[model samples]
Target chain A: MVKSRRTKAGDIGIAAICLLLMIICLLPMLNVLARSLSSSQAIIRNEVLLWPKGWNLEAYKFVLTDSKYTWSLAWTAILTVICTFVSMVMTTLCAYPLIYRDLKGRRLFNTLILFTMYFNAGTIPHYLLYKDLGLLNHPLVLIIPNSLSVFYMIIMRTFFYSIPDSLRESAEIDGAGPIRILFSIYLPLSKPVLATLSLFYAVGRWNGFSDALMYMNNRTYHPIQLLLYNILNAITSIEIQTQEGFASAPGLSDTIQAATVMFATVPILLVYPWLQKYFISGATLGALKD
Target chain B: MKRSSAINRKRIANYLRKYWTLYLMLSIPLAYFVVFRYIPMTYVQIAFKKYSIVKSPWEMPWADNNGFEYFIKAFRNLDFLYALRNTLLLNFLDLVLGFPAPIILALLLNELPFPRFKRLTQSVAYLPHFLSWIIIAGLAKQLFAPTNGMINIALNRLGFESVPFLNDPVHWVFTYVFLGIWRNVGWNTIIYLAALTNINPELYEASAIDGANRWQNIRYITLPGLRPTIITLLILALGQILSSEFDRPFALTNPLVNSVSQVISIFVYRYGIRGLQFSLTTAVGLFQSLICVIFLMAANALAKRFGERGIW
Candidate 1:
């Protein structure tokens, strides 16, 4: 009875600690949400705390109705989908040929790929190359240049190496080609890895702003993150110039920024829970071998 | 003999034919690397000449080789050095403070008994990792505002003087480091937690049976278990010492705090993009990459000597 009581007490203590930690992690985001929804007067009064003083959705309405935001969202979505597909295909195909243990010069190919992680042609030369190739302002510029990530390729190759040799041997005996075996046998077993890597590539493409800033001279081609960045910069400059304080337009102050952040964050956050299980597994599978 | 040689040739051809589709699939990626990665490497020579967009890189308009002209110029520029110093100093602070927070958090999380709550806390902690630097920085500015900011209001409520958080140069590094920890600590903790999961449970059971306390168990067992991961990640971070630009400082920088904010990448951007000194920009970039490569190699060698599995 005493031991049971002790265990119960321990459980309660752990539960309390966990709850506190979760709040700490989540408070900033919740604060942002609260500020976004509060009335301008309430924001000025600084009365808004855990909940908005007087709720309003004007910020959301403004951000959503804005053509820049909408166009950038469309741009981000297209880029994410196309980049994810290309990255996955490149990784899988490059990994497949290198996975064959008996392949001559496999070590050389592996080393060459790994070398890219440590050294690169630097940024300007890359820009010049894109300029020379007439890839500047082309949407494919974003997709093609960064299509093959050596880290992802290495992970895929490691996964392919783990597949039992007998599966390939049996398939070969049945007159199956390498491509057929890859499609029929290897790919099905690689679902977890595929999902994890796809999420990685998608998130990267969605969040990518530097490429848009550098390559895309036109404002229309900017991704959603870039748009948000510009808005944030504008807000900062406004605050710097006025010194009038956030209370002047309290309704617009907290909530709009918060809403914009949430809008940028929500899509990736929504996908994470669905792919959470695979993320850890994929990370382990990739890291454990080497 | 001729027949045997022909058969040998036929076998080689058959092998090539069998794997042709696989090679075909790999062609696009190979071409991408050649055109985007390898070919651009040739343009690094433009750093030695006065390069113009009108004339190709091979056509040098200037007679001077300019052996170290750009490097000397970049070194002499006080703004460049100030930026370099600020970058190194901030990175050092991040290494000192930011590196350990995740390990400690992971350790604390590991000790907690409730699984559901633990998982929930972890998810919440990692949410900020997905936020773009712009959003995070904006949030920071709002939260740390001198008058209307939540932090200052709380401090005033507690009867303390409100601090100038963002504008003050003295406070800039602190804000940068604090935000860095807030944004990245959870994501990094996840890696450590993953490492912890791989540790055998029996070792903990054995330590418990020996009457070891929780702290001792962590010090003796958990810390040792995390050594390889810590080392590997440290080496990776060291390799990125010259490359951490565009995210934290970029978002935090303003004219007020520009002294402490400009990093090597920002420097490159200023010279390359805004100034349009393409050759000088490329030279600076090449110098940064070379430094990173040397650091990575040295770290890898050190890891090998210490008997840890290095990136190599």
Candidate 2:
């Protein structure tokens, strides 16, 4: 029996609430998109809402043509790729070995790595360490220092633990060494986790700004997000050098700001579908059990 | 004895022969942890010393007040204390206002009559979580700016005064918390949704047979199912009482909101990075880290004393 049949009023209320939430999240983005497509004059006059008025592609053109914007995008992309690769390798190296029960010092290794997740030396010491190691203003500072995340490593390890030990044991019986077993068996089988983690690392590296902000003063080393931050904040210190790079390189920079925001964001938005597919399960699995 | 020693040596050799590649693979990461993670811990000594860029932290003279000078100074400084309070306040606001949004969203989602619409809503909801703070904050500048922003422009058209949704101190707090909730609430629902699935449907069936209403079923069954998760997450959140992401506020905050936005992380960035107050900044950083640890342990202990399975 349908003892608790929902009323029409309650259903409408729920639907309305859900729609409101969706709108709240979507409106800002749509507003930005509309503003970017609209004329700068329309934006200044507040004529544009969620739809464009006197639409033009000038903001996009300006963003694309600016060498400063182009270079920051290029560096961010490069950083994303390199950090993703290095992080995956390092995460794998830290994770894969821990799956074996017989691996010596596995407990100690696990403790040392996992402890840093909860607590660390915090910002200044890490900064001083970077300084001591000559990493200030260095590109490798981003790539190398944070190459491995213990949390992702644990997820990979958990996935590895789920695979049947008999498969590995059979390989060992056939004389497949540890490295060989990993290459032939684990690597090929664990594609989903690997992909999810790669997206995490890539997005992380792409959006990284505080590191570049703190460590990098060299304009050449700044990522897209850092450049976006500077532009949004309108740091007057670099206005002369970067005026052309900001908001269509001209007057009424709001439209150009929206366009620049779009330019900085669309890269991640492109890869987001792939991320959404794997991240839900990967995150739940990590969160619920462990 | 000689024969026994030879046998032990042979066993060690055999073990190495079998596991040499594993050891080789482990060495690089082990070295990485030691250098990148652990070495920084040793540098916390800078907080205790009169450190300068001219000399290594190791060679710095002991700070006046017998290595407690910087810590005392940080504690004494009103600016430092203000930032510390602001850090906790902001995080508390996020914890109070931002944490429950996901749970409510998940519950409403469960109540939805249609799966397709629910799925679409969820996908859209998850979209903002993926965008960086820079992107979100950038959008806010356009959408919420006092004079030229679309919202304010609409308010003016409606004959209402424009609101400083972002550029003002008090209004910025609301916007900050709102954006923080908007960004993470949907994504956070994943765990609760997963937990919801694990709630046995048979209980709902039995309750239905007993003529329970939808509200009763949810109040009795669904909520109890979600209790452990909520508590665990809350405890974990409490452990992070002093820590805030430098990005969220830093990205959104303007000069006008400095009174509220001068959090501990931003404070460190300014002093250590811009002002080059190496010793003082390190002391502050160390203080924040230690408090985080203490809060985590205390939260975990409190949870366990109350008979919840805390994240040990």
Top candidate, metric DockQ: 2
Across A216-241, the per-residue lDDT of candidate 1 in tens digits comes to: 77777778877777666655435622
Candidate 1 CAPRI grade: medium
The alpha-carbon lDDT assigned to residue A144 of candidate 1 equals 87
TM-score, prediction 1: 0.92
Clash list (residue pairs), candidate 2: none
Candidate 2 stretches greater than 4 Å from native: A1-9, A235-249
Give, for candidate 2 chain B, the lowest lDDT window spanning 10 residues.
Answer: B51-60
Off by over 4 Å in 1: A1-18, A236-254, B1-4, B61-66
Error of 1 at B223 (Å): 1.5
lDDT of 2 at A105: 91
Please report how far candidate 1 places residue A11 from its true position, in Å.
Answer: 7.7
* lDDT (CA) per prediction: 0.78, 0.86
For residues B49-79, what per-residue lDDT tens digits would candidate 2 score against the true structure? 9986688778889999999999999989888
